[model samples]
Target: MTMVLCIGHPERSPVLPLHPGARYYAAPSPVGTPGGDGTRGRPWDLATALAGGRGGSMVQPGDTIWLLGGVYPGRFDGTLTGTSAAPIVVRQYPGERATIDGNLHVHGAHTVYWGFEITQSNPVPNANDALETYGPDCKFINLVVHDAGKQGMSFWEDEGTSELYGSIFYNNGTHENFDHGVYAASEGGEKWIVDNIVFDNLAYGIHVYVGSRHPFLSNVHVRGNTAFNTGAISRDGFQNANLLIGGDVRTEHMSADSNLLYFPGTTGRNLRLGMPRGDNRDILVRGNYVAGGAVTLLMNGWAQAEVVDNEFIGAGTIVDLTARGGSIVAHAWHGNTYVRDPGARAWRYEGAAYELATWQKITGLGNTGATGTTPMTPRVFVRPNKYEPGRATIIVYNWGHQPTVSADVSSAIHAGTRYELRNVQALLGPPVLSGTYGGGAIEIPMAGVDPPRPVGRTGPTPALARTGPVFDVFILNRTK
Candidate 1:
């Protein structure tokens, strides 16, 4: 009975399209000379406005380079190339704050960096990276990469599509030689990585490798982001992990939603998904919110994954699949929610350990049920319907612990259009309303009853309605 559909009024990001041209300026103690002539009151030093010299003065394609506010040492490589609709921005100079103490490569393609701050402390043992791209449709916004002796931002064997929004990778591997805090690998394009904020890294905090002979990392997405205490300093005990998706190549259309993982004393492994020389099909692990971790999700060998609605708090062994071997196709672990620490054993197949009801009866695999704490589910909230233009205002919330007795709602309008059901309220129980409305569907049958539970209520509570479960449906549309 989990039917959540919140449509209209919330998706907005998409308005990048600019092409104006020339405007350069750089200063790390400017005021002319260092091969000045980058105009904007003659500015230029920051490696001569990114090495645009040798008698040609580069940085073309819809230009714009303004890095003005202090500290800007060594390495800036760039090469320039802008063209996915004329990009090549490189910002930071209005309310200033442009610190870049070293490292930043990018080999040339639609660039657009905005709001910088990469601090490569003493790097250079192995060319310590703190931002190294091979170029493609680049777009980093609000970046803040930190102290690195290795990785903090890398897209290495590049190809095309790339974007990392609202970034902030912290503490990065100093001499222990960084492993990742954002590292996308070879082959082709596609990667969005939204809202970012990876923490103390010394190994994986978002690493997507695809080696075993490249090709097949298709369309990655990773949403909302907020990883914590990543691998600390792994000397390779299987490279920790906060979000690692190794590779024998092939990982079509990936997705990691709602992210927010943690790993306190750090032993890492908040989400690992390796094994894909061929079938890792459409992978998706939704609504994440994992905690602490000894192993939050390690589905090593086989993959066709789709773990939904996550919330595995205080993990010690949430799901370990003993290196997975044979007969497990089309995997799915729905609604997820295991609180842990009473004896800690959620799962560990094949080598034996199962807990969530004997691991959902020998792996037909967790069907939406497991909770020792953190399970309130059932929350839908739609809007529009102020004065009716197509009207809509659903709000079903049943903070459960044993309540919801019946619920089967549906949406999707305009087939013949004529739905009408105003303000039906059911604070608790006997509201008798039964389904079938409108042509495009609008079914509803929300009978209720939930309240007892003080140690004297084992099941039914028909009319003692205790004020939990809130309801309100107000749809209306009449346009034949």
Candidate 2:
């Protein structure tokens, strides 16, 4: 039950919480104002600011709305609109952090939202996410979305153009496999998923699939992303792939390139093109580094494909070009490096298995391909929380069972800054260690520190393997 999207607003304005540009301030609960006047001394409540203005002062385009540093409880729906050039801006106040402990739905166009932490603060029986972008041509920058219910961000196709950039989505979704990190679709303009870190969600990490529901999905470019153990946290059987870009209908002009996909336990599936029984065109899957799994192309019509310079490391079907008995025209396939077991499923074409030599002979593709046994070496994968200057999400890939390793935080935190490190699994608990940064690496204790996994319903903490190739996630916070 969804309503048609409407992108219109009357003065269409917002003001930053930090920068200088017709700024307005809003606080919650105990820090609220009485008969407020949108001033620093007497800030309005969160609701008044979102509703355009109070009494005389109205939030206008190119304006900024500054959210005071505190938790804003309850679900909110913003209907502010802005012009194409003078879009509304909503930001956190100077050094203070703003936390929206409930759902947020933005129905305005040309809005720029920045630097906020979104999660559920209470029991949401129906279980909806805290983010939904129905507005077209908007930007979501540096959002930390975790431990929510259902989908992480419902970027509907109605949002003709939008960008999900420099964000972190993990530990989302319930036990239900229907949820996803980014449940998205597109019909007009571009839906860009760029430079993000998504992991351990219940279902697919970047699910750009609509099945037969939508007419078609197009113009989505997923680039420079790092997704691992996408569907491995909550469910078993390696529930879903790290990235998926297909539907049960028609999809065109999309690409998934320069991304890293890693799942070590079993088949660590990475990027998949075209769902079973769909049609795709002008697709590009290139420059991706995949480990433990492969770049699987399945059940669809790939009218044209450009797969180049991708490195695959695994013992199973590292590269399935035939599209699992679907229709595909792989025009350009070169510079692909395959590091697999000697006699494993390396290449399959026209419903048959073949080595590098035979695969080139029959298909005449992958002529410049090379095969070796050097897999992607395990190490720490770090992604900085770009909008929140001194914060980062790290993944410690302990391939050799190292008890502890020094994790570099110099990039996230410079010298003379105090930092706090915590295991994301035990995120609600105390920090693992806290000290001032000296432009050096932070020693992370891996194998010895096993935090019992947290769950919603009360039950025995499920047992997780802590053996070879153990991967643990951590958060580094720079104390203000």
lDDT string for model 1 (1-480, tens) is: 454654432332432436568888877874634677777777777666655532436667778888888788778787667787777687878657878887878777787777678876565453468788877787777677875767888876356677777566754654343467788864566777765667556677888766667666667777756665565433442247778765676676777876666664335678877653544555687877666567777776555677788877654787776333565657777777777743556677765786677667677764654676644665444433321244444444444533342232234344444444433222123333323343433433333333211112222322222222333233333433
| Stretches of candidate 1 exceeding 4 Å from the true structure | 1-14, 23-33, 39-63, 66-88, 91-101, 104-111, 114-174, 177-179, 183-192, 195-202, 207-221, 224-234, 244-352, 359-366, 369-480
Minimum summed lDDT over a 10-residue window in model 2 is located at 1-10
Best by lDDT, which number?
A: 2
Number of the top candidate by TM-score?
2
**TM-score for all predictions?**
0.32, 0.81
Residue 377 error, candidate 2, Å: 4.7
lDDT of 2 by residue, 302-321 (tens): 77888788877665676655
* lDDT of predicted model 1: 0.61
lDDT of 1 at 1: 49
- State the number of backbone clashes in model 2: 10
